[model samples]
Target chain A: EPEVTQTPSHQVTQMGQEVILRCVPISNHLYFYWYRQILGQKVEFLVSFYNNEISEKSEIFDDQFSVERPDGSNFTLKIRSTKLEDSAMYFCASSGGWSYNSPLHFGNGTRLTVT
Target chain B: TQLLEQSPQFLSIQEGENLTVYCNSSSVFSSLQWYRQEPGEGPVLLVTVVTGGEVKKLKRLTFQFGDARKDSSLHITAAQPGDTGLYLCAGASIQGAQKLVFGQGTRLTINP
Candidate 1:
């Protein structure tokens, strides 16, 4: 099966450092999303990207967060300055449908740790 | 804001047992999805329900969408140890290709 693939399965960075998590969504998928799960907490949405523009974002996706699709298959989430609270599992999802009825496929996620 | 509350946060049952996990929300959804997540891994999509009162079956797992589209349930019959995992329910509204709001999750253990 063609699954979403993420790089650096785990990341550890200094509190003030910047980090970029990468993902390669399925080739046929259109809409892409980024979500995070803090330990023992609900998976929270961070942002959504479609047609090369941001479709939606949550409050948690503040100035520190940014997403880009620099190429055909790559999607990335960059955090300007990592915070302790940023330590979580970051997941990337992709879907082929244009509507809510479409199912989203998720990657294994990158575990981020800020020291 | 949308929220999904899952009941029986943790469950431990023996093999061949039956169990039902619930996912509820106050806001109506255009679609709902169920996933099973293993420890230290991302959630794997099991099924997606689009219409109200829709039912989908996968092997021994059955999923039902609420009549109002605000809730859903997952029933497992004759569950095996392979069924042990964190089950999550998520919903999305119709306004846009908005982000999915996930439930806290139901941790189930099926011991053989």
Candidate 2:
């Protein structure tokens, strides 16, 4: 079965550096989302994108964070300036629709570590 | 903000034992979903319950959505060691956008 795939399973960057996390969602899926899980914390929604624009975002997704579908298959999340609190497992997900019943398919995730 | 609270943050039981996990919220949801996550992996959807008071069974696992759509539960009968993992519940709000609000998760250990 097709699945979402994320690159750079582990990422380590300096506190002030910029970093980009990449994911390739399921080919046929339309809605895309980004969620992050701090160690031992509940998974938190970062942003959702559809029709090439951001549909929703959480407070955690502040000025430093941005998402883009640079091409047909690649969706990227970039942090302009990384912070220690930004370290977490970032997951990319997609679903066929935006309806309540549309189950999301998630990627294994990219572990981001800021020092 | 919508929140899902899962009971019994951690559970340990021997193989073949039965167990249940509960997810509760004051706010109603349009749908509720259950997921399982192994170490270092993203959550994988196990089941989705849309209608209120609905019940769905997946093999030895059963899921039920509350009549008010504010709660749900997962019951595992004769759980095996393979069933041990982090179980998470997420809900989709009726008014909010498509983003899901997740519970803190329950860590289960089924010792064989």
Candidate 3:
């Protein structure tokens, strides 16, 4: 089965540095999403992208955060300036449709650690 | 904001025992989904229940959506060690965009 894949399973960066998390969603999937889970906290939605534009975003996805499908296959999330609170497991997901019938498929995730 | 509350944040039982995890919310959802996550991995979809009073079974695991569409439950019969993992419930709101609201999760440990 085709699955979403994320690179750099673990990322460590300085507080003020910029970092980019990379993901390759399922080849045939249409909608892409980014979600993060703080340690011991509920997973929170960051952003959703479809038709090459952002469809929705949460408050946590502020000025520092941005997402782009630089190419047909690679979707990237970049944080302009990292903060301690930004540390978490970031998951990339994709779905063939937005409804329940097309359930989301997720990648293992990228563990971002800011110090 | 929508919130999902999961009961008995942690559960530990011997193999062969049956267990149920509850996910509740004050707000209604258009659809509810159950996911299981192993350590260091993303949540994997187990089942999706869209209609009120809907029930779906995956092997020994049974999932049910509330009649009011505000809660759901996962029941595992004759559980095994492989069932040990973090179970999370997420709901899609009737009015919100395509983002899912997740619960804190229930950690299950099935002992041999």
TM-score of chain A of each: 0.97, 0.98, 0.99
Tell me the chain A TM-score of model 1.
0.97
Q: Who is ahead in TM-score, 1 or 3?
A: 3
**TM-score to true structure, per model:** 0.96, 0.97, 0.97
Model 3: per-residue Cα lDDT over A1-115, one tens digit each? 9989999999999999999999999999989999999988999999999999999999999999999999899999999999999999999999998878888899999999999
lDDT-better candidate, 1 vs 2: 2
Model 1's alpha-carbon lDDT is 0.92
Q: Residues B1-112, candidate 2: write the lDDT tens digits.
A: 8889998899999999999999999999989999999987889999988899999999999999999999999999999999999999999886434689999999999999
lDDT of each: 0.92, 0.94, 0.94
Expressed as tens digits, the lDDT of each residue in B40-108 for candidate 1 is 778988988888999999999999999999999999999999999999998887644547889999999
The residue-by-residue lDDT of candidate 1 on A15-51, one tens digit each, is 9899999999999998999999999999999998999
In model 2, the runs with Cα more than 4 Å from the true position are: B95-97
Candidate 3 Cα deviation (angstroms), residue A71: 1.0
After superposing candidate 3 on the true structure, give the runs of residues whose Cα lies further than 4 Å from its correct spot. Answer: B95-97
Model 3 residue B23 CA deviation (Å) reads 0.2
Q: Model 1 reaches what TM-score against the true structure? A: 0.96
Alpha-carbon interface RMSD for all candidates, in angstroms: 1.8, 1.9, 2.0
